[model samples]
Target: MLKVKFNCFFWLFLLIVSCEKETVLKEPVIFTLSSDSGFIGSQLIITGSNFGSDKNKISVSFDQIEGKVDSVAVNKLFIRIPEKLTVGAKLISVSLVDKRSNPAIFNILKSYQVSTVAGSGLFGTKDGNGLQASFSQPEELTMDKKGNLFIADNFVIRKIDINGNVSLYAGSSTYGHGDGATGIAKFNQRISGISMDDADNLYVADYRFIRKVDLNGNVTTLCGAMNASIFSALLGITLVDNSLFVVDIGQIKSVDLSGTIKVFTGDGSFSSVDGPTESAKVIPFKITTDNQKNLIFTEFSLGSKIRRSTTSNVSTLISKESLKLNGGLTIDREGNIYTVNGDTIIKIDNQGQIELVAGSVAGYQDGFGNEAKFFKPTGLFVDGSNNIYVCDTFNNRIRKIAPIN
Candidate 1:
C-alpha cells in the first residue's frame, strides 16, 4: 500500500510541473487602436495584433455602428459616422472568438451649422437642403425665436421652421398678379423684403407696399403713403424701439407703430443727388440694428458705407476700404458685424477692425473648398455656435462654416 501511494504522489507532482510549463508558453496576438476625437467625421485605428486579412474575419462594435467594417488599412480602420452622432460619445470594440477588449472612446463634434442672410437672394436651396444641390431665389431671411427661418422670395414668402418644415406666409401663385412676396414673378411688384418685429408680428415690404402678416398668416396692408411709390423699392427693413426702418434707394425711412413715416437718411427720397461727390452715401443695400439702437446698414455699388446719425456725423461701419460690397449684413450678439464684400465674407470688429472669415468660394466651385471662392456672395448670418452661414448667390446655395474647435 505504501509503495502504491508514493508512486501516485510522484505522478501528481510531475503532472503539476507539466501544466505550469504549458501555461507559461502560450502565444499571444498583438492589437492596438487610436481615435481622432474632434471631428464629425473621424477615424479609428486597430494595429499590432491578430487580425485576419479577410474583411469577413474581423468584426467591430461601435456605439452606433456594427459590421464587417470597411478596412481603411491593414492596421488603420477608417470610420465615417452619421451627422446625428455629433451629440454623443462613441465607443468601439473588437472581438475574435472569445477574446475581447474594452471599448475605445471618442466624442463627436459639430462640423458646422446652416443659416441664410435675410434677402441674400438665395433661398434654403431646393431639396430643402441648405447645402445640397437645390434652387431658391431669396430676397431676405430672418430667424424666429425657435430658429425657424423666414424667407421672402421674389413672388412669395415662406417660413422654414426648426424641423425643416416650410409653410407659405403669403403666395401669389394662387391669385392674379398683385404686389406681395412668394409669388410675384417680377421684383418690381413683389415683396422685396420681410422681417419680424419685437412683437412677433411679421412685416413685409412689397416694392412700395408695406404689409404685416400675423402668426396665423393673415395679411394687413400697413402704411402705404410712407412706403408706396416707384423710387421706393422698399429693399430692406429693420425694427428698433417699436419702429420699423425701411431702406429705399439711398434713404432710410422710419415707420412707427402708428404707421407714421419719417425720413432717416439721404434726401428722404430717390430725389437725393448724392454719392461720390456728396459725403451722403445713397443706395445702401440692407439695413441692420445694433443692440445699442444704432442703425447699421450696407451700401451696394462698391462705394464707402458707414453708420452715422441721420445728420451724417458718425463714422461708417461698412467702409469703402476698397471692397466691392454687395448683398446682406448682420451684427452678432457680441456686436461684431458680418458683411459680404464681393465674394468675400468679412468680419468687422466692434472697434471697426476687419478680418476675412471665408471668401471667394466661387473660385473653388469644384467643391474643393480651396481659395474659398464665392460666385457673387449675397447674404451672411451667424448662429450661437459661431458657425457662419453664407448665401452664395450664383451658386444658389447656403453654405455653413462650422467652428473647427
Candidate 2:
C-alpha cells in the first residue's frame, strides 16, 4: 500500500509541472496595433508577440503597400507609413517567418491640393475671373480677419469679398494723391505695399506716400511727402505696434501715428552696404515683421540680400550670400521667412537654411506644388492654415499652395 501511494504522488507532481509549462508556452498569440488611422509619411508603432529581433526579417504592409521598417524587437515593431498610398481605408499587417499577424484597418489622411483662387488670365477687367474677381496688374495683397482679400490693382485698391465679389476699397480709377473717403481718395502712380493694424485700418504705401484708410473708407496720409526726406517711391510697408515701417528705393523708415518720421536704414542712396542707418541699401522691396517685431526686408539688386533691423535703429545683414533676385518677404508664426526667388518660392528657416518650396520651372502653369510653374511671381502670403498665396504677376492670377498634412 505504501509503494502504490508513492507512485501516485510522483505521477501527480509530473502532471502539475507539465500543466505549468503549457501555461507559460500559451501566453496568448494575440498581438495588438497602436493606432487605426494615420497620415502619409507618418510613423506608426505596432506591438505584437514573437516579431523577432532582426529588422531585415520583419515586414509590414498597409493596404497592400509595403511600409519602411524602422525598428523591430521581440514584441514590438515600428514603421513609417508609405507616402504614396492612396487616401482611404487600408489593411495593415505584420509578418514574421511564416506566421502573419491578424490584419488591422488603417485610414490614410487626405492630401493637399493646389488651386487658382483669383484671376483667369493676364489683365482681365471683367468680373468672373475664377471667383468673380478681376485683376489689372494686381500688385500687393493682404487678407482681413474675415478671410476677405484686399488687392492693389494698378490705380485703385480693390477688395474681394469672401463670396468673391470685387469692389473698390480705396483709390479711384484716375490716379492722384488725395486724402478723403474711400470713394474720393486716390492713389497716385501705383500702390506698392499694404498692411493692417488691429483696428482693421489699412496702411498703404503709394509712390512717395504712406496713407491710412480706415474701415469706413476714411483716408489719412500718415507721414510721407511727394519728395521729402522720408521716402521716394515706397515699395513695402509693415506695421508693428504703433509704428509703421516703409521701404523705398534705397531706404527703410519708421512712421509714428503722430506723423513722426525716422530713417532706420539707408542714407537715401541706392547701393548695397551693411551698416547702420547711415549706410546704403540696394533697391529694397517687400518688408515684414518677425515675432520679435524685427523689421525684415528683401533686396532686388544683382547681389541682393535680406536684412533685419532693430528698434534701436541698428541694421544687420541676415544672409551671408546674396539673395540674387527675390520678392515679397513674409513670415510665418514660427518666424520662418518665405519669398519668391526667380519664379520659385524659397523658404529660409530660423537657422538660415534655404529651401525651395514651390515652382518647378519658370513659366505659367498651375498644377500641383513643385510641379507647377510660375511667371515672375511676387507677392506671397501665408494664411493661418499655412496655405501659400502667390501673386503670379505676369500670369495675372492668385495661386494657392495647400500642404498635405
Candidate 3:
C-alpha cells in the first residue's frame, strides 16, 4: 500500500508541472520597426521576438489608437496604420495575451483626403453646423492655436470650431471700415486676407487697411490708410516675427506692431523682375513666410510664378506659363509651398518641382487627391498636423485635406 501511494504522488506532481509549462507565455519584445515614418494606411513591419505565430492573439496600436495587424509571426508583424490619427510622432506597441511589447516611435506623414468642414454650398451668412452653415464668397482664412478657424466670408469674418460649428467671429457685415467690438466692427466689402499671431490676435487685410482684432473681440485699425498711396489694394497678409507682411497691389509691404508701414519688397510696378529687394518688381497677389522667415508670394503677372524675397534680394522660385495662380499661398512646416492654379491645388517643393495636390476641374465634390474638386479655391491654411484647410470660394465651403488611412 505504501509503494502504490508513492507511485500515485509522483504521477500527480509530474502532471501539475506539465500543465504549468504549457500555460506559461513569454512576453513579447520589440527589437525595431522596418521604418520609423510613413503616411496613413501604409504598412509597417515590426520585428522582434516572442510574438507567437497566432495572428488572432496579437494586437497592435498607434498612440493608443488600435491599428490593423495584417500578419503575425514569431519574430515579425505586419501592421496597417490606422486612420484619423493625429499627424506627427506616435507610439507603436504590440500585445500578446496580457503582455505588451516594448513601445516604438513612428511618425505619421501628411497625406490627402478632402472633406468639407463647413458651409451649405449656398451663398448666405447663416451660421450653424456642417451643411447647415452658409458663407458668402469666402476668401482668406486662418486658424488659431485652439483649432478654431477664422474665415473672411464676404464682408464679415466667420469662425468655425473643430466640431464643425460655424458662427460670426468678427465684423458686422456692414461692408465698411470701423473699429469697435467684434459685433459692431465693420469691414470693407473686399476683405482680402486674414492671419493670426501666436497670441490669437487676428490681423485682417480689408481693402486698403490692416485691421487688428484682439482676444477680447475688440477691433482696431493697425495700419494702412484709405488716402495713402503706399497701399493701392491690400490683398494677402502674413505675420512673421515682429512684422506683418501685406501684398499691396503689386508690392510687398511690412507693417510693424505700432502700425509703421514700409515697403518690404517690389517696386510697386506690375512687372516680374528678380533682383534687389527695392528694385524687384512683382505683381504679387498673396504672401506667406517659410520656416526660415523667407517671404514667399505668388506673382500673377508675366505668367504665374512663385517668388521668394530674402532680407535684401528677391528670386523667382517657380514659373509656369499661363497658369493664372490664385490668391492662395501657404507653406508647410517643411517649407513646401501650396498655391492654387485655376481650379487645382499645386504644391511646389524646395527644388521648385511643381506637383498637383488636389482637384482637377472646377466643381464641388469631395474625394481623395485628384478626385477632389474645388470651385475657385482661394485661401489655404496648414495646421500643425500638416492638414490643409481651403476656402472653396465659389463652393462657399471650408474644405479640409488630411492624411488618408
Query: Which regions of candidate 2 deviate over 4 angstroms?
Result: 1-112, 128-131, 228-230, 276-283, 313-323
Tens digit of lDDT per residue, candidate 2, span 350-377? 8888765677677766654555688877
Clashing pairs in 2: none
C-alpha lDDT of candidate 2 relative to the true structure: 0.75
- Two-way TM-score contest, 1 vs 3, winner: 3
Candidate 2 versus the native: TM-score?
0.70
Clashing residue pair totals per candidate (backbone < 3 A): 30, 0, 0
Which candidate has the top score in lDDT? 3
Weakest 10 consecutive residues of candidate 1 by summed lDDT: 363-372
Winner of 1 and 3 under lDDT: 3
Put down candidate 3 lDDT per residue, 22-126, tens digits, no spaces. 987878998999998865666889999999998889999898899999998669999988877876999988899999988999998655788999988999999
**C-alpha displacement of 325 in model 1, angstroms?**
1.3
Give the poorly placed runs of model 1, Cα more than 4 Å off.
Answer: 1-134, 174-190, 225-231, 268-282, 310-313, 363-373
lDDT (10s digit) by residue, model 1, range 103-179 = 66666543432233222333433334333323355546677666766666445666666665555656544432343
**Candidate-wise lDDT, in order:** 0.59, 0.75, 0.86
